[model samples]
Target: MFRLVVFVASLAVATTTAAHFPWLYVADDSEPRLFFGEGLDHREYHLPDAVAGAEVWQEAIDAPALRLEMEPLEEEGFLGLAASQQIEPRGFLRTTIDYGNYHGSRLIYDAQHFPAENPEAWPEPVLAPEGLSATLRVEGDQLVVVILHSGAKPLTGAKVTLSNAEGGPGLSAATDDNGSTRFSRAAMIDGLNGLMVMHVDKRATGEISGKGYASTTRILTATFNYRSREAAKVSALQPLPQAVASFGAAVSEGQLYVYGGHIGQAHDHSRENLSGYFGRISLDGGGWESLPAGPPLQGLPLVAHEGQLYRVGGLDARNASGEEEDLHSVDQFARFDPGTGRWTDLQPLPGPRSSHNAAVLNGILYVVGGWALAGDSDGEWQAGAIAYDLCSTDAAWITLPEPPFKRRALAVSHVDGQLAVLCGMTEEAQLSKQVFFYNPASRSWSEGPDFPGSAFGGFGLSAWNLDGKLYAGGMEGVLYRLAEDRSEWEKVDEFQTKRFFHQLVPDGRGGLFAVAGASPTAGHTGSIERLDLVFAAPTARR
Candidate 1:
C-alpha cells in the first residue's frame, strides 16, 4: 500500500535514517572504493544498476581530470566498485548516483572524497556535481563548513549532520544565511574518516524509471578525513625580562633581540617608566640573557639584515613622572654586530624622527610614516619618506618624494619590490585602517588593501615578511596574509590574546612570535606567545 503525501517547506526532514548515502573512501597510495551505507556503520544492500554503473572522476589541483576504471567489489562488508588505479594524495574523487525512485520520491546522491593532507593542497571542483556539496577551512582551532548547491550557490538553512567513522547518531546543525557553520576542531572525533552529510528535499513532480513521483530529494555528503590535531598551534612562551610597548625588536643569528621601550601604563609617559633594558633569547626556547643596555628609548624601528641589527631614530623622555614631560626625537642611526658584541654608529637620519617604521628592501633601508617629537609640545607630522643604501660605504639618508598622509605607530613591510606602510594613528590622533604602498622602482605611491579589523586595529599594528609572503596582525589578534594576487588581505588564523603596540617576529620555523605589549585583559604583560603552522599526520584507512 503506497500513498503520496504533500510535503511542505517547514516539515522537511533528512533521509539519514530512511535512506542510504553513497560514500567514496579515498586513501593515500590506495585504490578508492565506493560504497552505499547508513552513516559510518556499513551496510550491504543489492546495488542499483544506475548507481553501480555511474562513472567516477578524479580531479587534481595541478593536473587535468580523468575518468577512472573500476571493478566490482565482492567483499562481504562493502558492496560497490573499487577504482583500478590508486588516487594521488592531493586531489578529490567524485561521482553521482541516481537511486531511481523510492517511497513515492526520486533520490539522487552526490558524494566527494577528500584526502587527510593539508587543506591548502585540496583542489576545488569545477561544479557542485553533488547538487549539494561542502568545503572545509581551518581557522585557529575551529573547522568551518560551507554548504553549497549546484553552480556553487550557498544553500541557506540546509541541515548537515556530522558523525565519526566508528559510528554514532552524530550532531546536526543548520546552516546560516551564508550557508556555513563552525565546529570546534578540538571537540570532533578523531578517526580515519569523518562525515558531513547534508540533505535537501525539494517539492516537484517527477517521473523516474516509469514510476510517477510527486517530489525529488537530493543527498549530498562530504566525506572528510579528520584527526584531533592542531593545524596551527599557539602556545605561550617565556615572558620577556620586562613588559614593555613601543619597543625595538629584531632577529639575528637565530636569536631574538629586544632593545628599548616604554615600561609605563598606557598613555603614561615619564623618564622613570622608560626602559633601557636589552636582552636576547634563543628562538628554540630559553631564558632571556641580558645584553649591554642602550639609551632609554621608545617609538623606534629595529630591522635585521646579514646577521646584524639596525636601530633607527627614536624618542627619549627626560622628565620625571608627571604632566611636565620632555620628549624629543633622536637622529641617531646605529647597527649592532652580534659577532663582535658592539654597536657601530652609522649615518644619521636627515632629521630626528620617531614613531616611524622601517624595512629592508634589496639592500636598502626605507623609513616612512612618522613625525618629530620636540619637547612636551605637540609633535610635528611629516609626509615625506626617506631611504638609505645599506650596501654602499657612503650610506646617507636620502629624502624621497613626500607621501600623501602623516601617521605614526604603523607597520612597514617590503614584498615584491613594494614598501607597504600599514595602519597607524594619523596627524589628527585618529586610528585608521588605510594602507599605502610605495614602489621603489617606480617611485610612485599606490594603495593596497586596507587591513581587516576595527578602526583601532590599525593603530600600533605589526607586520613581517617571510619568504616573500607578508603577515600582519594588531589589536584584533587575527593574522592576515596578502593574497597571491596582491588584491586583498585574507585571514590566516586568530589567537586569544589581543593587544596593540606589540611586535610579531618570525619564529624561524614558518611561524610567528608575539612579544610583550599592553593587553586589555592583563594590562601590561611581559608574556610571549608563539604561533606555528602545523598539519596532522596522514589519516589511515579504518
Candidate 2:
C-alpha cells in the first residue's frame, strides 16, 4: 500500500508540472523533426506525459501527403519525424496538432511554401477535438457561440468569454443548458472581423492544480472563413532625387504627391539647403516632376481627400545656420487641388503643433495627438483629438475629448467607421505601444491594442489601414499587419532596406506604393518600391 501511495504522488506531481501549454515546433538542427513541448521555445520545454498523445493530420486541409503519423522520440515525449510533405498548386499544408486535453490544440501553417500558381479557396481548420470546443456562427447581426465538453456534450452554465482579438471591448457570458450564447453586433469590433476566440474556464472536471488530473481550460477559436489572398510582396522603386526625412505624401488623381522634407537623415542634420522640394510621380512608371513648392515644411502631415491634397501642422522651416527664421510648429492649414493645380488657404488649426496624425472617416477629418512649442523648447506630448467637417461650410474645428494618454509621431488609420491610433514616441522620449480608438458616431475614445512586438517610438514609425486591418512599421524596417481580433501582429514581410518615413499608399489594385524614406546607415533613398498584398479573392462568409 505504501508503494502504491508513493506512485500516486509521483503521478500527481507529473500532472501538475505538465499543465502548461504544449507548443509544437520544427527542430532546425535536424531534418525538420516535429517536437511537442511546453512553450514556443521547445528546447526549454518537453511534452508532458499526461498529454503526450499527439497527432499531425492535414487530411482536413486536403493535403493527405502532408499528414504525419506521429510517434514518441523515446517512449514518451511527443517528438516525431517530419513527414515528407508536398504542396498543392494553390493551397495549404494546414496541419492540426491533437495533443490531447493538456496540450489543447495547435494549427501549423505551411501556406508560404506552396505559392499557388492559381490560388483559390483558402482551406480552414475543420477537424478538432471537443475536450473543450467552441462553435462559431453568424446569425443575423449576432455571432453565436456554443461551448462543448467532448465535441458533443454541452458545457452548461460555464463561464465563457469572447474577445474580438483586435484589442477592444470584450464580452462575457454564461453558457445555457445547450452550452450556447451569443454576442450581438454591438459587442463586436467592426472591420473584417478576423479570427476570434471563445474561451471557457470553470471548476468542471479537471484541474491544472488538484485531484481531477484533467485540464479545466478549453478554448474554441473559429476562423469563420475570412480569407486574405495577399502575399506580403515587396519590390524596390525608382530612387528619390535626394535623401529626405519627415516628409508628407499623398495619392491624388493617378499621381503620387510628395511634399517638403529635410535632406538630413533624422538626428544627423547638416542644415543643408538642398532639401525642402515638393514633387510628384505618375502611377504609370513616370519620373518625378518638381511641383510648386508649398511652405518649406518638414515633419508635416499630408493627406488626400475629396480629390484635393492638404498639408497640416508641422515645422515650416529650420534655423539653418542659426540664422534663418523657423516656423516652429506651424498651425497653418491649406488645401491643394490637383484639378486646378492651385493652393487655397483654409481655417488654421486652433494651435500650432507637429508630429500629429490624421485620418478621414466617412466625410470628416480628424487630427489627433502631437507636440507644440513651449517657450522655444519642444513641449510635452499632447493627448488631444479634434474633428472637422470637410463638407461643412463652417470650417470650424470641434474639440473632442482628449485621448487616454499623450503621444507623438504615432500612426492612425480610419477603417470601418473607426480609427486606431498606433505606436509612437512618448513625452519622456521613450517608445510606447499604447493604442487608442475613436468612434465618430458615439464620439467616444477607448483603449485599443498595443503594437505587437514593436516599439512605437521609431524615427520612421507609421500606420495605415488595409481591408479593415491595421499595419504599422518602418521604425525597424519590418512591416507588421494587425489581426482584426488583435490577438497577434503578423509580420507580413520585411524590407531589404530598413527605412522610416517611407510611404505606403494603396495602388487601387489591392497593393500600395512604398517609396522615399531615409535609412539610418544608407542616408536617404529615393528608391521606390511596390508591396502587392497579392491576394485578390473576394472575401466570402463561411
- Model 1 weakest 10-residue run by lDDT: 1-10
lDDT of 1 at 516: 68
C-alpha TM-score for every candidate: 0.56, 0.53
Q: At residue 129, give the lDDT of candidate 2.
A: 55
- Summarize candidate 1's per-residue lDDT along 44-162 as a digit string, tens digits: 65566766787888764223577889778776776788887865544577887777676676767788877533343334565753477677766567778887886687888866667
358, model 1: CA deviation in Å? 0.5
- Best candidate, TM-score: 1
Name the TM-score of candidate 1: 0.56
Clashing pairs in 1: none
